[model samples]
Target: MSEARPYGFEVVRLARLEARLVVYDWAWARDNAERVTENWRRRVAGQPALFDGPVLLACDCAIVGEVCRLSLFETTYARFLAYRDGGSPDGHVANAFAAIVPWSADGAVLLGRMGAHTANAGQIYFPCGTPDPGDVRGESVDFSGSAGRELLEETGLDLPEDAPEDWVCLRGEGQLAFLRPVRFSDAAATLIDRMETHAIREDEPELSGIVAVRSAADIDAAMPGFVRAYLASAFDAGARARRRRT
Candidate 1:
């Protein structure tokens, strides 16, 4: 297994997910409750639709062989928003979520632009959200289920059970985005059409629209740093694969 970088994004492969319940005690959120509440108030004032729902945060992460273990604890989305917007003043904890990488048959992948009503409006990335109570099973979290639900909610694509299930971990700026690549039989354009149709019917769709990404060149500033890093790495991998095939 390769080592993850300290600052910029590093793609690390994983064979399994393991999480254990931890006691809730985020000192930053406690010490700054007044400030955090004020920030959330202002945020909701701007985006009234944002939800302060249940969410999870990783207190610690460690990779052992093919296993990726995390110490997780539940928290409110409002605290998460404040922590994220405050540049993550609490260095002890970080946001860890899973999302599916929609790789199509035509060598392009799909990303969605978050709608204006969403917390991350205008951002383009794979369909994923922070793990919530629904992801919890016993003392651990079901990351695969979490990723699948997000994809279906945003893209309306129900990935087949037999699709390729390779996993990659994107680590950067205290955020861990677990990406599971699902190769779709449909071409990128065809998949986009399907997603558009789905969006047309949603009362308030999570994604404004889908974009096809062939390489890092398609990445834009709207994409989060971790997402851009994955794109760059994905593009480089594609180039290397092409070179070897020739």
Candidate 2:
């Protein structure tokens, strides 16, 4: 078996989904690291004029099944003036606009390995249930509330009433934000099933599919590199906790 790679995130159980807690790793923040830092600097630089209309946002990436795997939460701010002005005096306005990286938790139920679409056309892997809506941008003063709203808009999956309130930060670039569910309830599962069925029937009616993975080998054979890394981290964490209990 191939060794698992280390990932800078953690997943905690929630009543209806697993909440992925992100450990910010500066080293992992590749390519766009400087851009993100510069963005923060500009925000701080313009704090006086930008504070009044600042908006907060949350976003997540999720994997679904018996052991739910999800990405970390991220928080970002969007300035209203950046939208209206179109540009900043310091040339940082582009980064200033739509600063609130919307929070969302997705349940990517792996339906086994199969050829599917990719940026590199013709290249394929086990495509999971409904690809994340990519990044649905939004602006709101209430990050949590706005996150919930965005989740509904993007996936049509409403979170359980007792879901966790805190946000988990993931390490990445593009000023993107994400959150993952800590647990999955029967109702949530049912909703997902319905959504998947609807999408398959309406979009790709001829395809055969299943929800989540049936075994470790299934996961191994199906998942893409990044997804595999995430699952390995989550499984390792779970195994360590279990060993501690015993």
Candidate 3:
């Protein structure tokens, strides 16, 4: 596939999100235990920073009104990683994640490049991570909280507690990415400086650097389908609007 040619996905606008913990057996993980282990071993050998820990996977999802509700269950990261490279063996579950789409006041959106030690090394996308047990409050998973937590952990930047309620889900490649758009009053350059400073101070940073997307041209192959879809629509529209105002 061309760098970004195969990157195709559907975007769904959402005003709210609800994820509930579910009891379901993942037959793929169970059925392919040996394969998952071998794949994970090879990955770790190349990138020792990867961890095969607990992560939540989506069992079911339905968009009702402005809300995206998901039924999720815990699974090993190794299993999810295995399916990410190889097509889903069971065809029912997906590695659902939440991401914070950081937009600058000047209509620029920022994406992060993964560090070499990461599983997705060299890939560029919004700061995100799969839902885990900590994301679950009682029976419901707080995806918004998860998104904010990931952005902060990855960039050392704090999102406002009062970010807008708007949300979007990009569905493709057996993954459901719940994205919450958060705007920064600072310009994209300023945001990049702060993030780079944070990375320098950290002992082990997840991101190697940040790239700002100002238009569809800025969207590229390093991003997954979901990330590409969002930027192609949102950033392109934003650029058009800015031009019209000019």
Candidate 4:
């Protein structure tokens, strides 16, 4: 059998409620797990000094007609693990980005599923802006651009030009704030209408589908506790703004 090609990030599909990722790997990740973990740790440390903790690397290999390797490196210390190299004084960050938690009208949240090219499919959130390897520092995809890019790349959604602009950045208590944008008020409704009337292409073999949750409680119920907490803060900020206007 031919060796699997090196892995690269790619969006397989986009659903009204979630986006799917496909991370491909033919060999058992275990062979390079430790080295990969250490390399990531070193990378993290070299970035701006932030949190502290042992970075935990978790991964899985799925064999479904094809072999795929999934890996995750997580740490509780927000500073050490969550900080990106772009924000660091020294250069060297991964050329990867994610849409953290995307929301639809009626407060339904979108999540992504893992596929042949993904580490793990999880809930969708705010679309984060990031720079390519050669791009200038701080030059990232704006909120609108990121959302549109993610929607198109993941789900092939040609979102209308009149998408909403309610968003927030989830930085540390006071360190740096990462922006999260909501493209539409009725994103779920818009998505449902699209799915029902639109024709979906199956050319991509990586993404599975997007999943939606109706309420904050529903999101918490479907996702990990930590994820729930992270999402809550974003939603809470929006709620607070709404309350102020009222």
Question: Mind sharing the TM-score for model 3?
Answer: 0.93
Candidate 2 per-residue C-alpha lDDT over 94-199 given as tens digits, one digit per residue, 9 for 90 to 100: 1111111111133333322231322112221222221122332331123344455544443344657776554322222222222343343544356456546545
List runs of model 4 lying over 4 Å from the truth: 1-34, 37-102, 122-144, 159-167, 172-179, 183-190, 193-200, 221-227, 237-246
C-alpha lDDT (0 to 100) for residue 17 of candidate 3: 83
Best model per lDDT:
1
Quote the lDDT for 110 in model 2.
Answer: 32
Q: Write the per-residue lDDT of candidate 1 for residues 1-246, one digit (tens) a residue.
A: 544442388778787877777787888888888887998999999999988899999999998776788888989999998999988876888899999999899989899999999999999989999998888888878888899999999999998779766678887787888999889898998999999999999999999988888977887889998888788887877798999999
Candidates, ranked, lDDT? 1, 3, 4, 2
How far is each candidate from the true structure, as Cα RMSD in Å? 1.6, 13.6, 3.5, 16.7
For candidate 4, the TM-score is: 0.44
TM-score of decoy 1: 0.95
The models' CA-based lDDT, in order, is 0.87, 0.35, 0.85, 0.38
Task: Work out the TM-score per prediction.
Answer: 0.95, 0.38, 0.93, 0.44
Q: lDDT by residue for model 3 over 179-205, one digit each (tens)?
A: 888888888888999999989999999
Candidate number with greatest TM-score: 1
